[model samples]
Target: MTGARFWDMVCTALYLALYAALYAREIPVPAKRRSVTMSDVAAHAGVSIKTVSNVINNWPYVTEETRQKVVAAIEAVGYRPNHTARSLVTGKTKAVGVLVPDVSNPFFGTAIRACEEALVEDGYSLFLCNTNEDAERERYYLEQLLSRGVDGLILWGARLSCDELEGIVGADTALITVELGEEPRRSNHTCINVDNKGGACMATEHLLREGHRRIGHLAGPLDRITSRQRKQGYEQALVTAGLEPLPEMTVAGHPSVQGGFRAAERLMRTQKPDAIFCYNDLMALGALLAARYLGLRIPHDLALVGFDDIDVSSIVEPPLTTVRIPQAKLGRLTGKVVLERLRGSEGSERVILCPVELRVRGSSGNSFGEEQKKATLDALISSFSDGGERPA
Candidate 1:
């Protein structure tokens, strides 16, 4: 053979040898095992497929002996019925859809995790959709879930009207709302709620008992029930304390950091409230930053309290005092309610109201010092009336 041909033959032989060695080292693919079907189990058990189906479906008429035999056969074959086929027969997908406003929000994220865990225990899966708090987007996702045949839905802070919800909650589809209360006398669907009003009242009353009569509120948007309820609580607490809820003391904005900053700025410009209660922790954090930038000492100059005791709330400077809600419990309860409805229970929809509590911390400090309490109150009142130039 020529030299080049000899070299080429040698290289090819080496390559083939390496390929064989690699192939020998690799794990072999096992033969694909066919899944055992109902027919196979029935034949082995000496029973008809219909009898086996009746046993599987838990129909009342199956003889106990026959049911035992069929179950044993199923166990022997390790048979699992095709869920899709079973769903077709029963007209139930055994699935729940969850629509959240913002999955990234810690509260929503925790809730979704809890809901998934709870539903999985009942042999149901979760189909999650993020609506981003957009009414149009929420409606579109709702219709999609319904069209895809989810057995029920859990809507987080839904913006839809009673009429719209009624149209969707027609026969066979169960609906539940989380973190939002039902409108007056509207009783079609179930609702899971945190006590927004009570939480706000506790937060505000905490400030009031601490001698913060000139309190400000960094309120959330007026559209949501949570925002509105918290506002009501704040106003009620002030009235109960015999103090008017001054218009200059409250500013409405989004439930975000920037929103809180803007609202605080407005309050600081008009009248420096002795304390501020934010709608949520995110807003409270923003207010905190604003207070720092304006050279105001927390609690000493302006007490700060927030709702939603998220993890970060404790880690922030001064360790915010806020209201803690059972976010995960709320989600788990909602899942259970939906699962119950899917299992053929029917009645007036349930309303599960979760409780809330205030977590005291440094932000809402001892406003009433032995020597400074009266002086601080006078200073706060003077600050409100002075109309002094606000921080830029």
Candidate 2:
């Protein structure tokens, strides 16, 4: 063979060798796995598939020995029940739906957790939906949840009227609505009521007892029932003290920090009240910032009070004095009510009311002296500088 022919053959051999090495280095793709089935478990347990089905569904007639055998076999075979198939046979999805105006809100978050805690014990899962306080969104969520065959629904601060709700909800799905205003004329569902009026009164009364005469109110959106009820309570407190509830002293805004800031600033700039009672904790936080911006001292120049003793309420600059809603208890109660409705234990639809308490803190002027306030503020500042740990 010529030198050129020998060189070409050598190069081809080298190329083939390199390609084989690369292919060997590559990881092989895994094949699709077959799921473990009830048949496999039944075969392993030496029992009929019908017996396995009876054990899974808790049919109450399976012998304990057979049940243990099937369970052990299921564990060994790694069998997972088909939820869709089981739901079809039982006609129950074993799920609950929860609709809230704002899921990000701390109050709702606490309530949701509490409700879920109560529900999960009974083998029920939760489907959470955020409506964002929109009527159309609320309707869409209701439709979707019902379509998924949720066993029950818990609605918090929904805007849908009773007629609208009745028209949409079927008889099979149990509903428990939170803070939906007055008792419904129709009685197809249960209502959970919180004492917004009484809670507001408590906040206002606390400020009054602290000797704040020219007290003002930073109200939430007037359209919301909670906001209106809170404002009414504030007015009632003022009237009970033989003081007129002036329109200028009561300002309405969105139930948000920005809304509170704008409304509080406007109210302070024009009316110049000594103290302010806020609609909720979020608005109260805004009012605090507004007070700082307007060169007002908290509790010294402009005392403040808020509703909804959220977690942050206790950790703010001087801490906030606000009305506490007992959200965990309320949530657990809500879950219980939903369960009762699901079981058809109640003869008629009814309303349940939850109570509230007032937590006094530094911002209310009666608690936490100047030195302790300074120490708390210092600790909070240090916590951020030292790895963002919360102060105990």
Candidate 3:
């Protein structure tokens, strides 16, 4: 063959080879998978869309066999019911709002977890919002929850009054408030109060029995009804014991560790109470630290007591003596009641006072004036201390 003919054939072969390789490397784009819908499920199950809707909504009229068929078809097609559309048809969101003062606080955290679990068991979603004990923040969350059309609300330590809540919350919405205001009857909501006064009275009486004549209280914010109730109980117990409830012995704090530390130091320095009762476990923990820093031994030089037996209370060097409020039970009960209201089984507006038990631990002494030699408090201090010095 001639040189030109040979060159042209070679180039043609190379061109064909390159074209084949390029075509082999190209990937065919797959078609987008359409989202599986209730319509698809109905079609797959050989049932009407209405049947599928009824089944999804758990309408009791549907036959068990038909429900099974629809459920099987849903599994086969991986069809997810459109929650928005379902909510629109049912006029229910199947969502509950839980507003608390502080989520970071263990007391509220445990309650929230228990409440969420209970709600989830009934196919309801929980929307959590922390108000941080601010009225404006609480109002904002309330408005937001209301706008979202939540079917129910569990307000813990709510700053808003029942009238304010009723103004924002729809009449159809179920409301449950934990540790709220002193209003006897909201007539539209259920209130759950911890026996703050009774618990306080018990703590004071226990200290009195221990022979601690001078007992100081590191109280929570006075504006909060829980705080006031606790203060009242403290005073009642003191009066009952033939002891005067001196104003100087009561110090209002933020109901936090730091607050407790400051309030405790002030109380110890000025009032010099042989025994101290704190509003909650957190404050008591703080008071414990303050006592250690001041070189006073627990149950010896100073007897300590607290409320709300939180988890950390037991794990401390000396387990805290506190009033157990059954926080988890409170949460579960709140969820149960709210669910009942949602199902139209509960309609009466009432107040529930959950019982509190006193858990006596090493913090409080068995008898007064006992000189017990305790350890140097180095372990607990090192665990939580910020390595900061006490104020001069």
Candidate 4:
């Protein structure tokens, strides 16, 4: 063989050996680093870029054959569309912001879970924020969420004023209030709320019917609408029952366990109330603990009732007989309203007043040692005229 020919053959052999060694070593070559793009998928699928876009957006214009081809190509090439780029082009984030006072509270937790489920069904994401019942924090979170370009906002606290809320409501962005009253200025925003006054009245009347005339109320901060409405209801019930609403029978504090404990301690020291109605179950639990510290027997020495029949209420030593609010339903309704607004539904902001029921357990009883469980149960059942069972 010729020397040049031999040299060429040797070079070829060496090149082949190097290739085999590399292959055996399994050393991955640096790829071109091409980003997954719509054009790439469209080219692979033998379709137009618009057709690929249509399939990705679930647009109805694309034919089944074309959509199937595009989907197959996308899967084969691992072509995932950039959601951020799509959102930028469409100017729609497809996200909703939910702001609540306290995420730890069972009522808020249940509401958030329901809202998440409803939004999930509609192919939307949720950004949850907890304000911890701080008005300043609520406003800051609202501004931050809005600035993040969420399509809609669901507010569950009474921190925003009418003027402040007006700045947030507009055509592009929708607003919904959960467990709060309607904004007087912007009647266009939707709201889902409970009849706070009515529920408080029902609870107070239950104690009254059980022959507890000198009932005291553990009130929340008067600045909040729920607290004000509940206080009104408690007073109204007393007036209706021919009992004078005395100032000394009410104690105001934060809607917290510590607040409840302090209020109950003060009430007990000044004038021991035969029965006590707390603003919420947390407060009621605190009052119960305070009563125990005082060596008082529940229902026999001091009857108690609370609101927001949270999960812990049923697990306490003596199960709490409180007012039950449909927390999950409230959340689902809030999500639905926000979605409707997003769809460009126009009308007066809907004000949904969900009903509340009294849950009678072993907490409230009569002086004769007879548990008012049957009467409370009957009342709760009768309150639900639609025949739906109360939340267990």
Candidate 5:
């Protein structure tokens, strides 16, 4: 260990010692008592300081009577263990930090919950921070978490700079980055990512299968690696079909419903592409809204396909066809990766691309006439409401 780290451990040990001493004080021999100590608690309880230590540490060796006395003395003196100092000594805080952008997104929320559940099994608490897609805030939170001695970090740093990532590597922390590509540094940073390009291509190809020649794209910010990859996938799908994608058909937006709405609206007014493949589900929803505002019927007028089959994707007015990513599974895998690293697995930096599948629904021209069948079923239910069980 470095000299600084060694001294830090020593200081923490001193604090624990002093803290125990402060609770052990006896009545008024001021000079003899160099401040309160665990000895004081022992004196008050008529037992050895070691007994008091056992009570404090919950060592299970102290008698019931001695435990009660230590407990009473502890309550009388308001003694509490300094967790920070203890963590410094043991090199562990039994906690992990997770940083994600926009915890409001259901995708992120599901991922976070899965991570928490996985970590809980190992007696690790989760400390979550929302970076709001800001690089500065991500760096600040990283520093704070490291300073507090978090055992590991699950970083979803789409906006972090290479320098910031390298610094993390330099610190030798166990970090697993989700939703971002490989760090452009010599850092031992592991990565877990969804197949954005593959999913996008799948969505685009679905639209192509429905004979959409002028398929537009509502894309996420290019600064995001996923966004750029998805955009490339869209272009690739069109080009492979012997159609050159028009540059003017793609509009960039934040990965949000509002961003999707605005970008889709702008594109509709200017280009009026026949179909749109959105970067994600929220943007697709926005595109749906924008299409409705333009007096267009989904699939019949303008088809749509989206990525990330969020829960609502199947519940919308026209159930959205989307690429289904295993978000919760991703979270569980990431947690396992972190736990393994923490347990002294110095494996090389690894990358995992979780698989995705396409679920075709009315939004992308329902694959097997399912929407029409559903429409028939809905009509039957409506007729029953009108007191006519049989269709006329």
Candidate 6:
């Protein structure tokens, strides 16, 4: 698409997003002095009401100049669509249900914002709901939204059981789940998740290439699928580097800052490691704080890296070398998939894997550029030869 068309779509989506969010928050709409209608817009633009309808519906035959005129009149009068009437005619509520585990997490926050924008552009509003990581809460919201006549659902949490989730898919509700570790075994539901294992492997390998033979991992609970995959990837990277996988090197946590802090402190006192890779940014932050409390200088004494390049990752002391997940793109893709199912144009999008990359920073004490890698490898050889300290 051309740049102009891209921006037009974005602006349109954002305008609808603002209104949808306000409605969900229970804010009262401002009453207009005079009710604005298609007729009013038509009169203002000096076109017939049918012409105005064509512009609103994006009819291909309408001239570009005519569409611009109607759009301008729409802004001037601040007219909103009569979605109730439209739904009555089309059998679609023109609204979508959204479930998120934690909006406070920057990863979820960015994805939710993007999903809302993309859905709104296609004339679908969102019923925003936060589940707070409770499987029962997620199921309750799922039922509630479905009962309320939402056209589709975009969910970010997977605490619900396979049977419970299959019930929704059985109804053909046009659902898409984000960050699910495993794909749902249903024809109606689609799953989109980042390459968690691949990204974790990248983070661990980066540290290994930096000459840190003794690297530790601050991991999430093994019960969770995502955490298990990440830990597996970390171990795989060690084996690939020809290092024996040490069972004591993995310290499990809750994927939170406090979890990371306690885990790091415990590891420091028992198993000494030259560097640490956390499952996420929040955990890495906790580890960073723990390192300070132990009076160990970062990079010089303990190198650090984290997953999920959250907003704070770049602003933290010495910044963080981490994995960057394209959260917004994930959201946009989910939005598109849900829409397609609702429209009957597609089925079973299956699994969509988004790409991730490493962001080199001062926390690693060594960037992974070509020259730096060569120098670091040389240093690694020297450190092993005579047991000398490795150069950063």
* Model 4 agreement with the true structure over 195-234: per-residue lDDT tens digits: 8999999999999988898899999988788888899999
Question: Which regions of candidate 2 are displaced past 4 Å?
Answer: 1-32, 60-68, 185-188, 347-349, 370-392
Q: Could you give candidate 1's per-residue lDDT for residues 1-392 as a string of tens digits?
A: 89999999999999999998888677879999987899999999999999999988779999899999999999999999787899888998888899987777777776777788889987789999998878899899988998888888889888876568668667558777876667423443677778999999999999998988889999987888888999999999999999998887889887788878888877877887889999999899889988988999887899999998766676566778889876666677888888877766666456767888887777899633434433433443453453311111
- Per-prediction TM-score to the true structure, in the order listed: 0.74, 0.83, 0.84, 0.82, 0.74, 0.75
TM-score of 5: 0.74
For all candidates, the clash counts are: 0, 0, 0, 0, 7, 0
Off by over 4 Å in 5: 1-82, 183-187, 347-349, 366-392
lDDT assessment of candidate 6:
0.81
Candidate 2 C-alpha RMSD relative to the actual structure: 6.5
lDDT of 3 by residue, 307-389 (tens): 98876876675778889887777888999889888888745557888989887778997432222212223332443453211
Q: By summed lDDT, which 10 consecutive residues of candidate 5 come out lowest?
A: 383-392
Count of backbone collisions in candidate 4: 0
Q: In model 5, how large is the Cα lDDT of residue 369?
A: 72
lDDT for 278 (candidate 1):
94
Task: Give the Cα error of residue 203 in candidate 2, in Å.
Answer: 1.2
lDDT assessment of candidate 5: 0.81
lDDT of 2 by residue, 1-392 (tens): 99999999999999999988988577889998999988999999999999999888777899999999999998999998887788898888889999999888888887788899889987789999999888999999999988988889899987888668867886667888898886754455888888999989888888899999999999987777888999999999999999999999999987778888999999999999999999999888999999999999998999888998776877887798888887767888889888887777767448888888787788879567777666655764775564333243
RMSD of each: 10.6, 6.5, 9.7, 9.7, 15.3, 17.1
